[model samples]
Target chain A: MADVIKTATRDAYGKALVELGGINDKVVVLDADLAAATKTGMFKKAFPERFFDSGIAEGNMMGVAAGLATTGYTVFASTFAMFAAGRAYEQVRNSIAYPNLNVKIGATHAGISVGEDGASHQCCEDIALMRAIPNMVIINPADDVEARAAVLAAAEYVGPVYMRFGRLAVPRIFDEDYKFEWGKAVVLSEGADVTICATGLMVKEAIEAKELLAAEGISAEIINVHTIKPLDKETILASAAKTGAIVTAEEHSIIGGLGSAVAEAVCESGKGVPVVRLGVNDEFGRSGPAVELLHIYGLDAQNIVAKAKQAISLK
Target chain B: MDAVIRKQLKIKACKARMGIIEGVFNAKSGHPGGSLSCADILTYLYFNHMNVDPQNPKDENRDRFVLSKGHAAPALYSVLALRGYFPVEELKTLRKSDSMLQGHPSVKYTPGVDMSTGSLGQGISAACGMALGAKLGGKSFRVFTVLGDGEIQEGQVWEAAMYASAKGLDNLVAVVDNNGLQIDGKISEVNSPYPIPEKFRAFGWNVIEIDAHSFDEIDAAFNAAAEFKGKPSVIIANSVKGKGVSFMEDQVSWHGSAPNAEQYEQAMSELQQALAELEA
Candidate 1:
């Protein structure tokens, strides 16, 4: 197995989609003219016949994807997070989600990682939008390995799914041996002080926070909740029960995001764990470098450590 | 057309309209105006035109029908129920919890529903895809979709229209239910989709215009579209918002507002007379 390092989930998604297309002839890709940015150009090059470039019409592409899904084709609709979840939300909700089609929406450029494109392109609110739609399996892989697993999982899972990936490459966190499972939380490390439940890019951040907390003698449990919907309820409940405190971190809005999903699961399970959701505080991100944006939004490991300390202090 | 079958279709259309009336009136919630307006077209499609068997709703080679203007689901539900997709008794379950007949067409719940629809301007795209699928599979099945004239304001419809034309989807025929009313007011007042036939023609479709309510015109239009080869077709059916009900006819307020008990009785009486005249 290759040494585990943090890599962008988008790259992993690109690689996995190409692999999935290799085996499954029914697998087709439709991009809204963002093949290069969305990292689906590789698939387009391989399968010219199956690849459809709808030329920047996100809504039309979404409808086309839904149309294709109805015909017994496994359709992967790719676009930027804003266009995929924001621009074509109605299409996703009605056309694909409503019918429960086998459509995989690969939404990239999520969060402030889409720097220089500014606020319009950066989709901090995508998770909220997709999570609100019923029957949509929202998965944000923590790293490249998880992203590959997510792509395979979505291919195997028979329904509409929203797989969000960030464009910026971070540290590769998972080894080649790491397996991906939908709706399951992987506990990277377990501790009794507090559970640091995180998703997407923040999983890496939480891991680092755990390392930092170790030096301070605060044993924090680090959980990578890659799947946002069908949230790993057992893992969450067990972790909450053991730790008695929780903090959810994500590169998204604190509202209706990873934190909110975690809160809902915990509330339903009747767990009274105090949770501090660490994310953007109802503000649009500014144009900056990816690391800068993460720090500015209080989504870095330092912030996670601070929140975990605060959450643990209460209990 | 056989005289007996034509008479049966007329009877079916009357029953479909009654189903729409009763379904909507009971729900106290539905698009009665558009439902009534498109009743004849749906009746013609389900009863006379398509190769769908109620016993085998999910038949692989079955003709696919998509109601793009999904607010008109009451009409579709009525037609499907009367056609034996399910019991006519289920008509009362429209929009109710655990009912297959949702506010809009739901393939998940409804037996005969091919595609779930509520969002305007999407079903056409799905229909196009089905036609493409049929072509790819070397199947001879045809796909039909109905869109409200007002619903075409959504640019996605045009996108699907262009895709269908570009693909030369001959097996696909779209019916533009040209009732001028939308939710707020007249479609012209909202966003005029004037010259709908010309618009479709310009988009590389074989265009036909007809009085949507008249079975002769609808049958002729379908036959003509079926006969044409190499290109997709669009039949722009000129329809009133509320076609048969005297008080509700041409009324924009009926777009989603259901008829009360009195109005429902009156509408039923009018449709009964029409059915009697056709029967006679």
Candidate 2:
């Protein structure tokens, strides 16, 4: 461990917005009255004139973002994942994606990690919903470094992007100098027996599982898939060819998150590599502590280790 | 406004109405009632009020227009064509496969459209964004959008309205085409957004009422919007469901129904007569 620093992805996103605002004068921020919670208030504090509070209206905020994009501004609109990806799905699709507008949707409080809010606030299917929209680039960063880099990358990319951030503060996986590339998975650890592909908060768990598996003499490769929409098929296929077994981990539902995406990629590749998925089985989250919920939903390192073992056995 | 200018606008509007009919008739499915009702407002904006060039549709300094009531794409397509954004003959390809003229206003496919809009109540929010962008950039270009009377029933519309006022977007103007009908029936019978002006006033907007069919009133309302400072303006243009065509006037059936062969001919003949009278 390199003296890991713990911070929420939302906090990194807010800091990145302030940094981007200083670098790019055309960068604008919009939040639906969740500035304090979503951490967009940092941008508001830095540039009050450029920050727009849409007053608890997520759908209208999306449309406004699209409008701003048309006028040569790179817009970052923030809200909870449940509201941004669920309530305003139509607005994002029609206004931003349909036109291929340059709007970055920075959605925080994603998955069951949004503790104490229960199912109504926690979003488990945002990846599925956002992935269905055409011209939408989905980026779910795992740590502070990747989240900050993803925000900067999204600002430069001139199209609709959905960046998922977490409410819970997790350990920093990457260092300051780590280069975040879009659509390219980063291999954190190398193994030969099985591949563990994960996204968002689960990437940290995957690393922990990698250590546990190493102790058990099971070689497991850990890959961080940040961009979920344009999945790094080449990297995943290569890993599958090398390992012949795979396990996917995510804080979302197993039905349509990282697990389904990897499964689809493997099926498309015609690789007979058996895959095990570790995530919340189709169910809503309860009002509990985020760390406890991760354990209850089977999204911890132990679960990943178990799944990797199962995948290797099947292979 | 002089009679010559008014006559020119009238002739142009009549031809645009003819284009609307031609497009819907060819598509075999489109909204004509709201299109016809909003023809004059679209005509005034494209022809007389907006400082836009068809050749430079994407010019950063050019004024932007959004048809928030996007079901009336036939009207906007007609105006954009006559304004030379594309060939007027392309109007026949409206709603056809492999054509740029989609059933709704598409900023990607359409040359002169500033924003893509089909779902109601979202266009005005986009307009507010443009206005806010202009303010942030210290640019002088203005943004205009047209909304349907029934579309105001959407909660998002009110949300955008509140934002526009709070931001002091004086460079934006929204026109509500109060044709009094939606897809179902009368707007009041369905879900009345009555006292529209008061609602806008409550949102802290500079409100104006006008007859949508009158060029002078349309011209004056836009001029007033430009002069008003520190707040966005909303023009509630009272209009007939189908203004020029007598048979379709106030008929909810024409809300989204395209005309048949005979009906198309009847509409063309009536529009041609109106054009002749304006030219005379």
Candidate 3:
């Protein structure tokens, strides 16, 4: 394996916001009293005038982002994923998504990786909630390189976007030269026996799971799906057609995260591939060390390997 | 305010009310009560106060307005049409399947709409954002928003209020149409956001109270808002639930119900008479 580089996606997001601020004078950042936590404080340090602290008002911050977008500004509103996507769901839907404004919602601390804060702070349903809104683009980047690139892509896009980031530092799967594409899945490896589609922090786990499967004489394809909303149906369907079996993994709930998105895509394409979803089953995340929580909730690489074997058996 | 200008504004207000009636009557559904109540305020803002051009609706320098109480879109649509944003004939297509005039204000569909608003308590926050954006961009444009009396019951409104004040958004002005009614009943009974002015004052805003139907007070309030510096302003315009038609005035039943054929005729007749008197 290439020398692993560990960094939180939120760190990349903060650095990206500062870079965007320098490049685009119209870029503005708004935070709801979580500037230091969400990492928008980096942008705040670089450009104090453009950063707006909404003072613990997530819903108002969303409306402000929508309002700023109307005036030709690319507004980045940051907060915890639980608050940005869950608490302010209606504001995001009505104010940002409904208008199709040029607002990028940079939601950090997503999924079970938001350890110690427990289920109240961890957001597993943001992707599902955001996907339901029309004109909303959902992006969940896996590593530092992808997170930074996704921020730039979201800034250039002329509509509302929801970008999810995690709290814990994870293994960097992509190098600095990696380019992020919207609505296009990046195939990490090619195999015909089965496919493992993953997103966000789970992409690293899927990579680890592929090696484990290979050791058992099973070949597995690894596809990193960064954009969940405008799902790369063509790539996903082609992979499903070739592999004829799928194991979807994520650090979110099994009900409505990347797993659900992949299953829906396969079903909609009428590809009869049996998809074994590996994620936190219908349960809330508990307070523990992030890695331990992932293991307890069955969201680790071993879980993905098990699901891949199950999918192969079903096939 | 000059008598001639007041007379013209009254005429425009009457015409705007007529458009509201035309829209709701044709659609067979809409919130006419709140729309009629804020007709005078909308007329004053578009025709007299705001520096907006119908031909250049998307001009970056133009003043922005957000109808925070978006159910009152009929009032905004009527004013925009009268201001030549689109044809007055388009008012009849409101709430239709493919019409640009949606059930709420949509910036994408409607011209002269600064921000798309329908869900209560959100528009003011966007207005704050616009005001802050103007400050950040060093633009001279100002932003204005209108909210309903009952709509202020939303917690988000207070959150936005705190933000506007904390940000010292003097370029932003919020007008609350204190019509005293919502869909259920009187605002007091539904959930009283009473003492509106004091509440805004508590939030560090320069509060201005006015009779929303009076063009003189509406004009003066806006001017006062423009003059205030270092803090946001709120104009609490006390108004009737339904102002123009006699039968509908202050009637909570008219909150979201459209006028029937007989009721529509009565409303049009009343508005036309008012317009004729103003012209005289």
Q: Which prediction has the highest lDDT against the true structure?
A: 2
lDDT of 1 by residue, A145-256 (tens): 7789889989999999999999898777887788887688999998989999999888889999999999999999999998988788899889999999999999898999
lDDT tens string, model 3, A146-196?
999999999999999999999899888887999888789999999999999
The TM-scores of all predictions, comma-separated, are 0.94, 0.98, 0.98
By DockQ, is 1 or 2 better? 2
Residue by residue across B72-180, what tens digits does model 1's lDDT show?
A: 9999999998889999989988899888789999888999998888888888888877887777567899999999988899999998888888778999999999988
What ranking of all candidate models by lDDT puts the best one first? 2, 3, 1
Candidate 3 error regions (>4 Å): A1-3
A172-270, model 2: which lDDT tens digit per residue? 988899899978998888899999999998999999999999999999999999999899989998999999999999888888788899999999898
The segments of candidate 1 whose C-alpha lies over 4 angstroms from its true place after superposition are A1-7, A267-271, B1-5
Which regions of candidate 2 deviate over 4 angstroms? Answer: A1-3
Whose lDDT is higher: candidate 2's or candidate 3's?
2
CA lDDT for candidate 2: 0.93
